[model samples]
Target: MFTRKLGKTKIEVSEIGFGAWAIGGDAWGPVDDGQSLRAMEAAVELGVNFIDTADVYGDGRSEQLVAKLIEGRRNELVVSTKGGLMGHHRDPNGEPVYGRPAKVIEAFENSLKRLGTDYIDVYFCHLWWDKQEETEAFIEAFKQLKRDGKVRAVGVSTENFDYIKHFNREGGLDAVQLDYSVLNRSVESEVLPYLEQHGIGAVVRGPLRMGILTGKFHEGTTFGEGDIRRNWPKETWFADSLAKVETLKGLVNEERTLSQAALRFVLNHPAISVAIPGAKTAEQAAQNVSASARPLLSDEDLSIIARVK
Candidate 1:
């Protein structure tokens, strides 16, 4: 596993970190809980020390499972989870809720209890709330946790490239997570340059394009009912995204798996410190970890990818 210093924070993590959201099976697809646990165990066995999760994932079920998964071996792993979008799927609709000052602290404590750890290696603001006051509240809340020695670093996960640039330029965060994938290169136009200049490292999520880039689904297969892909109408993002993947596949033949190519492509970005891709099975986990072992593509292949409409 290759490790890099994440900006100026002096923290090191494997280039291929295990993204833990798949264990939730809420936003993604149907996942067997046992297989997911095995995947987590496989990541550790394979020498991946960093794990990323969110409080809303499966509504905290994910965190508790992680707690159970890494119980005594906490020191060997870097557990990073996100907070700030509260309320409840537990309440009524699948609406965006929030955490008050006290609730925010309580949420972090509860997440620790669930992960069975004393401190979180990294914590992020999941998405963004409407109010700056909420951000301030979170700043205050996490500041307390940091002062109390509960969190090692702070990051923000957002799709807003401008905001990522703004955050890094302002200089309070240790890291930032964003959607940076073969399909999502907008981050490179601005966000990545700013991060590099400001000395902030990026955690690239959705590198698989939510599995569309994995060479799994063909034109015929349809997503399950609960699958978030269902929410993205087939006529819109799915069709366009699938078409793009096919174009990319032509550039990468049987010489390499598109999955491998996609993984290598994202990590090759100079600004990326780590790429977190979710795996539902142990085999998939191993494949993801081994992707970094593959040699990078030539400049022409990347340009070919860039020209695909």
Candidate 2:
């Protein structure tokens, strides 16, 4: 697998990292724990060194599973987890009541326990906080974690550049996770440029656009119970995204699958440090990591994809 330097952190990570969301077995659909463990094992054997999870994902089930994956080889991988969704720190609208330093620290401590690790490689604030005070509280809280040798890097998982600026007002941000894919180019306009300019790592979350860019779903496709995509109304972007995938399918050939092409497209941008595509099984995990082994998209193919609308 091709390795890239995660911006600012200087940690070399595989260009294709494993996103552990689906293995959490809640939002995506039913999953088998044995299969999940094997998927991660397959990824690691393929040289995947980075794994990103969240406290909210299956309410820490993902982190616990990750703990099992990293056993006896914690130093061989880079683990990232997010907080900011726990405790009684939310308003009536369910928006997080940010600026609570104590609660933030508590959340991090709990995550450490769940992962069965003394320190985390990367820690991200799962949600965006608009207020300056709230951002300052997080900065301070994260600073404490770093000082205590708990977290190596701190980031915020948000697309809002404004919120990023507030959090980085003191210049303490290391990375940011945002959704980016062939079907969604929203981050290219400003967010990506800012990260590149400031040397912040950009870890893409949804490089396959929730499997739509994988060309596995068709107009007649339907998701089963507990699948998050089941609620997507086909009358809207769901239908539109499927049409765009047809155009993208032309890039698929004996050299690569549609999913590999989509991942390559995301990695084409210089600002991206790594792309985390979630996999539920060993086959899926191997396929994701194998994208890095294929040749990059040719200029002609990129030109054709650029005009895809």
Candidate 3:
């Protein structure tokens, strides 16, 4: 496995990180503690040094399990979890009330207590507050946490192009977890180049495009209600994302899966610091980590990748 620096910070992570949202086991679907621990163990054994989690995920279940999973192995991983997105209190309309700083800090502290660790390796603003003052407050709160040794450094996770650059200039985040993939090239237009210029690491979240890139889902494939796949509407580019899968199918030999190809595509770019695709089982974790050492596609294959739907 290959490791790289996370932005200009001293933190170094495996190119493939363990994305722990699923370990929280709610929006993605129902998962038991036993299965969750196995998934975490697989990632660590395979040299995946970065783990991404959030406070609002399952309202602290994910963080606590992560704590137990990493209890003695803390020195080997770059554990990054986020705050913001108030937990379990949806409005009457069933929308999350995000960006309550005082409450958000309370959430962070709760995560710390649950993880049973004194400090988190990486903490991020889960999302922007949509107001300058609020965004400023988010950054300020994270910065204070860093000073108090509650977090190593802070970053932002979002897909908003305009907001990423604006926040970079104004809020001064150490990193930003932006969405990017061969299918999602919009970031290359400006956001990625911006991160490179500013020395802000970009931790890509959906390199697999919700497993659609695995080229295994057929037209009739359907996820159950509790599955995260159900959370994404059919109208989403990813839900009905078979177009890119078919395109990628044309690029690789039949034996190579879309999962490997998609990951390789993201790592092909030097600007991409790490790709944190989620894993629900040990097999999935092994499949993802293998991409780091795999041969990159030929230029011709890459040209085909660029042409993917």
Candidate 4:
């Protein structure tokens, strides 16, 4: 796995990080703890040093599992977890609660206990509450976390690119995590350029479009109970995405799988520091890490994937 510096921080993370969302066993459907551990172990064995999770994911289950895997080997990995969002375990979505220093500290403390670590590599804001004053207060609290040695660096995972641009202007964040992939190129128009210019590391989530780009789902495919994909906007969106995936399959052959091609397409962008694709099993973890071995997509390949409507 290739490594890159995480913005201005001294930490260097693997280009292919392990995303622990699925292991939480909440919105992604049923999962085995043993399998989750094995998958994390497989990722580590394959040189994956970065793992991203959140306090709200499975209501701390994900963080606990990640802590179990990296317990004694903390120095070997860089763990990035988020806070500031809280809610019931049964609900996949969490309520945004930021600004209050006490609440922020409490959330960080809880995450620390679950992660079994004294300091987090990168503690993200999780989501912006859309209130400028509250957001500023949240950033202040994050700085305090760094000053207290509870966090090494601070980041924000938000869809509000304009807010991110303003945050960057104020020198508030070291990294930004956003949804970006072959099927989702909305960020390319502005967000990518802004992050690149400001020197903030960008972590690409949903790089496979929640498995739609993996070619594992087709029309009429069904997800098990509790799978979040089942709640997606509309049926037409899925059908349209599947059609685009078909066009993308022509770009894949014997040497590469659709998932690998999809991941590589995201990494091909210079602004992306790493791409986090969730893996539920050991085999999936190994496959995700191996995607970094393939050469970057050519200009023509990128054009083909981008032009697909």
Candidate 5:
């Protein structure tokens, strides 16, 4: 797999990393534990060193599964996990719970226990906070975690660049995880450029737009009951995304699947550090890693993509 520096942390990570959300199960329909392990092992064998997960993912099932993946290979992998939405401890109103430093530390400790690790490679706040003061408080809490040798890097997983500004107010932020795909270019206007300017790494999630860009879904596609995308509006957002995916398929050819082509399109930008596409099985994981070996998207292909929206 191709490698890239995770911006300010200077940590080398596979350009195509594994996103562990789906493997956590429940949220993405039924998932086989054996398949999940094989998927992780397959990706690791292919040199996938970066994996992103969240504590809220299956209520810690994801991190526990990842703990298995890194058991004997901790030094070889870069793991990024998130917290802040677990609600283990909350205010009476349950508002701004993570704004409290103690709660932040509590969430971190729980994540560490679940991951079976003494220190996390990258830890991100899993939700956004509109309140600037609360956001700054969370940043300070993360900075304290770094100071305590509990996490190597600190960031927030959010699409709000304004929230990101607060996270990086003191210039201690190391990275940010956000959704960016051929179908979701909203980050290009602000989030990507800010991360590039401020030297914060960008870990892109949803690079496949929840499997739409894989050309596996169509207007007739319907998500399973437990899958998160099951509730997406079919006639509106869903139809529009599939329509755009059809346009994106023009870049696909004999050399790569549409999934690989979509991944390659995301990696085409210099601003992006890594793309974490979710995989539920070994075949999917191998397919994601294969994108790193495919040729880069050409200027002509990009020109065609520009008109997709």
Candidate 6:
């Protein structure tokens, strides 16, 4: 419900954005297009102006769905999408490929067509390239898009905080999306501080830790066959995450649900511009936006959550 400025781009976005990965119906599991559309519409109705999707998500299916939902109200929304990761219609598990200048141009064109938009508010390099040279080339290409009015801002999504620090130092990006949650505080050490100092907006993904922070599962919970969680390392990673979630239950009470507290925890940070949590149904969308209305976590609440694992 609250809005924040996205770096120096002059674009204002909702604090709780719609994460469109699950709506794409690829890595997460099977998805219903009807349900996804309703979820997106519900988000818009609830005042969500930001939507983040990737070109690789369901091979552009997510962008198409977002396009369908925001058909007549393009100017009212700040739609951000990523490119550079390549996937084919036949091969769903293909590896990501770094976008050279030519690839970057082609990817932007494809995403524009899929999203049915003349310009993207923010276009991120889906993942960091192995070489700085490659990343520079992509940023140059993104600048070209900006010059042509095809893209308004450029960003990068990555876990490597060092790359982010360098990019910020060089003034190469307008925003940075990274995985950050109560369970994942690695970004607090350096990445967050640097972004805040440089006036670079930070879009936090996995604010709910892929649903673990929602308190929806227990130790023995089983994921569906096609679910991406099935491939997660259950012996240590999954079990440990579930254990952390149990510890987080104390933060949830009559005031809010575990999911709501989890979202607010990420939003409490001064450096964070928005948190994108994925939803597949209208009820889920409503539940997520409700968190934006709640007060942020207190110092004691943050202390308690920080003690987990």
Candidate 1 has a TM-score of: 0.91
Let me know the TM-score candidate 6 reaches against the reference structure: 0.93
Q: Write the per-residue lDDT of candidate 6 for residues 204-272, one digit (tens) a residue.
A: 999988988888877767778668888565668788888788788889878789999999989988998
Comparing 1 with 5 on lDDT, the higher-scoring candidate is 5
Candidate 2 steric clashes: 0
lDDT of 1 by residue, 211-301 (tens): 8889787767777766777755446777788788878886566556888799888888888889999998999999898887777887877
Models, CA RMSD each: 3.0, 2.2, 3.2, 3.2, 1.8, 3.1
Give the Cα lDDT of each candidate. Answer: 0.79, 0.88, 0.78, 0.84, 0.87, 0.85
Residue range with the least summed lDDT across 10 consecutive positions in model 2: 128-137
Tell me the deviation in Å of residue 32 in model 5: 0.8
The prediction achieving the highest lDDT against the true structure is: 2
Local error of candidate 1 at 132, Å?
Answer: 1.1
TM-score of each: 0.91, 0.95, 0.90, 0.93, 0.95, 0.93
- The deviation in Å at residue 78 for candidate 4 is 0.7
- Candidate scoring better on lDDT of 3 and 6: 6
The collision pairs in model 1 are 67-115
Report how far residue 297 has shifted in candidate 6, in Å: 1.4
Q: Report the candidate with higher lDDT, 2 versus 6.
A: 2
**What TM-score, to 2 decimals, does candidate 3 have?**
0.90
Count backbone overlaps in model 5.
0
Model 2 lDDT per residue over 1-309, tens place: 999988888788999999999999889999899999999999999999999999989889999999999989999999999987543367687655555677688788889999999999999988654555556667889999989988999999989978877777777899999989988898899999999999999999999998888898877788899998887755687988887888888899898999998999999899999999999999999999989988888987887697774
Number of backbone clashes in candidate 3: 0
Give the C-alpha miss distance for residue 2 in model 2, angstroms. Answer: 0.9
- Residue range 229-289, candidate 4, lDDT tens digits: 8755367878888889888987786678889998988888888888899999999999889
TM-score winner between candidates 2 and 6: 2
Model 5 spans > 4 angstroms off: 86-96
